[model samples]
Target: MNDVIIRTEGLQKHYVLGAETVRAVRGVDLTIHSGEFVAIMGPSGSGKSTFMNMIGCLDTPTAGKYWLDGQLVSTLSEDELARVRNQAIGFVFQTFNLLPRATALHNVELPLIYAGVGGKERRERATEKLRLVGLADRMDHKPPEMSGGQRQRVAVARALVNEPALLLADEPTGNLDSTTSEEIMVQLRALNEAGQTIVIVTHERDIAEVARRQVHLRDGLIERDFLNSTVETTV
Candidate 1:
């Protein structure tokens, strides 16, 4: 009743890999409230990635229930899930995931294009988002023309273009250096301070510390859930 943005009850996912049934997620029960910044931390093969895929609506749960923004996501069909993903969530990947040939502005506009937004509106909104991420001057540059941090900033801008209820970042700083990672964290902290609900997945404790709460996953089950002590001081 506390304005939950995401809720999952007994969520589960299983994968068959080479005659072995891998239980990626086993009964994950979670509640993420609006405007909360949460991090998911786990070792490799601990099922955090699978959990993120389920939360982002990129993959279906093998069983159990998931609700996003008061709607039953686990009950939705593939097409319906796609619609929900476009409307309710934004994704930031470990890699920048920008097209090499596309300009930064065009890369940021990709989501708008899929959503069928008008070209003029897309350009205006993309520009505003890029400016917000401190990439206004590099709108015309391609991925190869930008540094790793700059490319990631473009990806962040793209994610924000939809203004979705949830921002999902999966190892967003994995590809960056330590300095750049801190810079990206600074930006994310600022966004969270501005009331963006964020769910970040990372293996690094330093990175996970940026969030207000942390959920630890092990062997496809939640091992720990606690409030993070390192709150943003400057943001």
Candidate 2:
């Protein structure tokens, strides 16, 4: 059976700036199955970010439909979308959005805190996720104390601590150097191997190459959607 984790039909987002209409995303129909690692690639103004916002439940579409894990989220209220985002989506960003003063473990525990998880359980779960990202020894270290790669790993751990069904990474390697970028991609590959669904948005072909499938967008439409038969299967 094909377990579709994300499905969108006629998804569109438009905005008006003093009579100038901006069609950010126009009629994007997409499907992402469970455990698949996919990348959404596009140049600036190509609407990839708008498309990502729609699927990530961070923005509402002006028109169209969206289904996430079989739930119709397109028409959901803001509060409902918030609930779904917290329970089903994990977000990794270009910047390692960590609290400057908090330790790595505490930073990872933020999601659980928002979910109202108990202290002991939250600590244990955050610890496990940090360890999964190879940051076991840096639990007590603050973000400033870690290297660029290590801080991003901490961000990844925070994203996974909630055990979200879909992981949305937006320009995850944008800030890292070539070597550190590869390190992050390798970690993402391992997470996919362990059955986490991921969708990354990036303009860099090299970063997108790490994903098994690539979807190219242009002018708010999908230009190509194909499997990367030659994508490296191992880190």
Candidate 3:
């Protein structure tokens, strides 16, 4: 099996703003292997968000090459990128981006539904994901009926329903309390132990401490990339 999940070479992004050009990502060369959990850490305007967008397939790099799950993604057309995003990447946003009115199971099933999965398989996958995330009993509950943590768990379930190659989370704990954030982190760590390749993008140093590896970004370039020797190994 291919071990490299993500690889980038000379990745750069620029925005033209009314005569003044903005350099979002200067030049980043990164490689993330399978079954590895990593944190993309950076502060505001550090190019973390732009880098996340490129890696997530939500935006294309202005100058560079990107490979996702062994495919050349930097040059893929929009339609192709969309396909890659749906099949190879799963995203969990900070706001617990779950459908307010849909049941947890239904919300988790949205991706499969979009992928044209049959109703039976969709339900089965969604149920399994919810169960994996410790929300088996809350499958029928809507986002409004659950606490912030539970809702985020549902979002995690939804992201996993597709069995993505990479689980990408953006400031996942931004909306949760300390206790709840730890709960979610424990759940994520469990998933990582199960061989899932996960990447978390965040500005919070504490939150990044859980990852085994961290890539620090500054001014659109990687400032430091190293194994996190001080990772909190306890739940």
Candidate 4:
């Protein structure tokens, strides 16, 4: 079996604004292996977000190919893409996207519910994931009852309930303080160490340093992709 969880060749995305065409991603190529932790960093309008969307199956490219776990998803229909997304990807965004009225367990159970899992099994799975994120004691707590970090942990737990093949985090630390950001990063780092393949998009250099590899983009194209020998071991 192939270990390459993500591979893209000559990937391109363009947008037309009136008569002018904006080239968002210009023939970019990338590959990420299983269990690898990678960070994509770039300034505003650098196409980092666009690239993330493409790889996450949230958007399609105008040109080029995207092979996710050896499956060509760039050409999949909307319904097919949604199916692939639910089965293969977990997303953690800056906003912690939790239901205000739901308990952490219920929030985590949402994904499994969408996937047609039974009530008993969904509860078991959600509970296990919350435990993995160090929130076993907070299963019954609602979003309003938790701190920002705790809410983000709930979001992380929710993301993992479906056992996705890839975890895509977009500016996960953007809404947290420095200390809380590190706290979240610690949990994410632990998850990666336990064999979760993660691709995080961040513009903060410190946040990006936690990953083993970094890919930088500029003007809609890759500027550099290199191993980070000095990746921080601590959150």
> Estimated TM-score per prediction?
0.96, 0.97, 0.97, 0.97
lDDT of 3: 0.93
Please provide, for model 2 over 61-129, each residue's C-alpha lDDT reduced to its tens digit, 9 standing for 90 to 100. 999999999999999999999888888999999998999999999999998998899999999999999
| Pairs of residues clashing in candidate 1 | none
Candidate 1 residue lDDT tens string, 17-65: 9999999999999999998999999999999999999999999999999
Candidate 4, 19-78: lDDT as tens digits: 999999998999999999999999999999999999999999999999998899999999
lDDT of each residue in 1-235, candidate 3, tens digit only: 3499999999999999999999999999999999999999988999999999999999999999999999999999999998898899999999988989999999999999889999999999999999888899999999999999999999999889899999999999999999999999998998998999999998888789899999999999999999988768653
Flag regions of model 3 displaced more than 4 Å.
none
